[model samples]
Target: MPSRKPSASLLDSSQDDPSPEDALALAEQAEAEAEEAEAVAAAARARARAIRLRNQAAARELLAGNDTEAETSSAESTVTEQAEPTETAGAEDADEAEEKEEEATARRRRLHIPRLFWKVLASCLAIIAICALLGASGFMIWKHGQADHRRQLTAEFTAAARQSVVTLMSLDFNHVQDDVKNILDNSTGDFKKDFEAQQNDFIKLAQQSKVVTESTVNAAAVDTMSDDNAVVLIAATTRVTNTAGAQQQPRSWRVAVSLTREGGQIKLAKVEFVP
Candidate 1:
């Protein structure tokens, strides 16, 4: 029997089927392409990562440089600020020193004095000193003269007091008018007026009573004395001859006398007996 003719469909199917070797070759080619594609993709990723890292490094370096520049600028500004006051203070000190030097120079320049004016001023001062000394000497002399005058006045007052006391206390009845007149001459003020008014009566009483009196001053002292007034304490003893008998008595008296000087003579202004 002859082999049956293969079917057309079977023939076509057999022609369409690949051999195993060819299939293996095709699979190997596909694997090679896939590996190449994967390698290319990995290279692209690596390049991107390296570029990113480089960019980041550059950015960090830029920031660091900026920070360093900023710090350096800040330091420079601080140094400038610190130096400014020192420079200003030095300038001010220099100006002050120059001003003080100028003032000293001006003072030295202004120190000139004229010799003539200085001599004149000194002469005037010496004249004034001499005048003052002369005036003081004159005043001292005047004081001494016044003291001598006061002593003279005191002596005169003491003599007058003794004389007046002796004249007043001693009285004689036979010469009553003369005795009263003598008392009137030595006495002044109220004592003079009162004695003058009672003169006639005193004379009559003395003539009738036949009274005779003699007084002697024992001691007298001036208590207070001034230029115009004096107080004197006088102690005396009196002998009285009356119709009954003759008696001697001791008496104490105080007298205030006021004097006025007129035409270089001291006259009594007031006289009083103090109890």
Candidate 2:
């Protein structure tokens, strides 16, 4: 019969049912697609891993460079700080050395002044000593000369007094004129004038009395002596033989003799007898 318009269910069931070859081919296609998808996913994962590894390596390199820069900066700062201290020490040392040199120079200058002053003082003292020595020597020479002159004056006065006493007391009446002349020659000043005024009388008396006298000086001493005048004390004993004396009689006489220097010669100025 119209074969019945074939039932829809059958037709549909036939369409749903696949052939063996077709089923096999589909299974193969599905498996192939799955395999392709698996391959693509694996490729993507490999690419992402490679990219991450590259980024990590780049970051490590940047960090190493920064550490190196920091270390270099620290080292430079340390070196600079150390160098600053060394420079300051060197400057201080130089200043100390200069100060010491100045102090030494000042000490030398002070020492030099004292040495010069001592030398000048020593020279002055030496000059003063020499002058003092010369003055002392001159004084000694003057004193000795004065002592010698005084001694000579004393000797002269003594000798002159002795001679005058002997000559005046000793006389020879036979040569009365000559004896008188001798007395006159030795006499000067007041003694010479008085004796000359009585010269004739003395001659007459000596002749009439026939007087012969001998005299000796017992002692003579200088009482006062000066440059131009002197006084002498003369003690003498005289033996007289005359008309009034009967025989030879001894008489003691003490006479004060005054003398004056005339042109370096001692002459009698006066003769006085003392009781």
Candidate 3:
């Protein structure tokens, strides 16, 4: 085939498809896309490189430290971000855990009662026991007081009887003085020696003065008495006749007497004469 020049019409048609400005703009666009792709590839490579560097730094820190520090670094420590908050997160976590535990502990502690309750219970019981004991003691004291009053009444009655008996002895039984003396020598005697002696003395005195009569006994009631371990005291009053020589007049004389117990029976101790 012979070399020939291309037709200008085909050249013109092809030229019409793309102007110079359009071609230049397309070239510029392609170059900008290429530059953007190169920038993205570089960014990805840098990110990968940074990740590798961080991992290496962590491993190095772990290796360089002791067992405790290595564990700390291996767990969460990083060369870049290590200084930022190593203890803050752990301490915060610990604080939160401690706070929760303390709250739980407080709740548990509230359910337990103190020893003071038992002590209070014991004290109350002791107080009640003491009150009961005191009440019993008071009752006993009241009972004893009543018994003492009864004993005092008995003593008064016995004193009256003893005095009455002594007064009786001084009456018309002037002839009975020797009989009383003999009775004193016998254990089976109705009266004790001091009692008989006292009676006998009064009888002898009454007969000597001749103021006695048989009606002396009939004019009165006599005798009620008691004794203590050591002694007895008594009181009495009496009426006796004073006679004139012709039996024409009989005047009455009043007498009072006190007696005391000696050797287990009442003895004449004193007398008061009343006219």
Candidate 4:
């Protein structure tokens, strides 16, 4: 038998089949191309991101500049508005203070006193001082006059007491009745009643004894005095004589006599002997 002739399809298939080494080379080349394409795409994306970041930075800078300008304008306008009002208020306060000072000065000038008015005030003060001095002098003179009058009254009382005490001690038996009568006349009140009641006995005793007494008042003083009454103290010495003639030693006597104004005369109301 003769070998069959190969068909066109088989011939073509066998020719198209690659060798192992060629297939390996083709796979390596394809992988290299794919890696290069991927690298190109990554580079494109990186460029786009860089462009976006730059634009954002520029936009923020522009916005910040605009805000700063607006704020500066507004602050300048506010400062200008406030400055005008503050300056005007300061000027007005200064004017008002100056006007008040001027008014106070004018008021002081209006209330000023005149020289003549001061002179008249001084004259009135001098006159008042003179009047006060004269009044003081007059009061002193009146006080002295009152003292003199009291002294005169004391002397008068003392004289009356001395005279009355002397009268009482001087008694003679022969003139007993007359002496008793004189005693009764000089006295009033309890003294007069007591002596009158005992007068009869006193007269009888003197006549029987032939008694005679002469009295001398040594000293007299007004102890107490009022408008209508006075008390007087008297120191007296008496000489007594009987049938024996006269006593060698005179008897000393102290008496207190109370006198009252009766019928415009100072008369003894009571008498007491003092030890």
- Candidate 4 structure quality by residue, lDDT tens digits, 5-87: 43454346557786788667667766776777678778877785575455444434533455566654554344335334554
User: Runs in model 4 with CA error above 4 Å?
Assistant: 1-117, 246-248
lDDT of 4 at 105: 90
The global Cα lDDT (0 to 1) of model 3 is: 0.52
Q: Could you report the Cα RMSD, in angstroms, for every candidate shown?
A: 25.1, 26.9, 13.8, 26.7
Q: Better model by lDDT, 3 or 4?
A: 4
Ranking by lDDT: 2, 4, 1, 3
Worst ten-residue run, lDDT, model 2? 1-10
Best by lDDT: 2
Residue-by-residue lDDT tens digits, candidate 2, 6-113: 235334654767678866766776677677778888887788567545544443443345456675455434433443455435434644675688899999999999
- Expressed as tens digits, the lDDT of each residue in 90-191 for candidate 3 is 434654675698899987776445566777899999999999999999999999998897677466534544544443444444455654554343211233
lDDT of 4: 0.76
Clashes of 1: 0
After superposing candidate 2 on the true structure, give the runs of residues whose Cα lies further than 4 Å from its correct spot: 1-96, 243-249
Q: What is candidate 2's CA lDDT for residue 79?
A: 37
User: Clashes in each model (backbone N, CA, C under 3 Å)?
Assistant: 0, 0, 3, 0
Question: In model 1, where do residues sit more than 4 Å from their true spots?
Answer: 1-118, 218-233, 243-245, 259-271
Ranking by TM-score: 2, 4, 1, 3
Which candidate number has the best TM-score?
Answer: 2
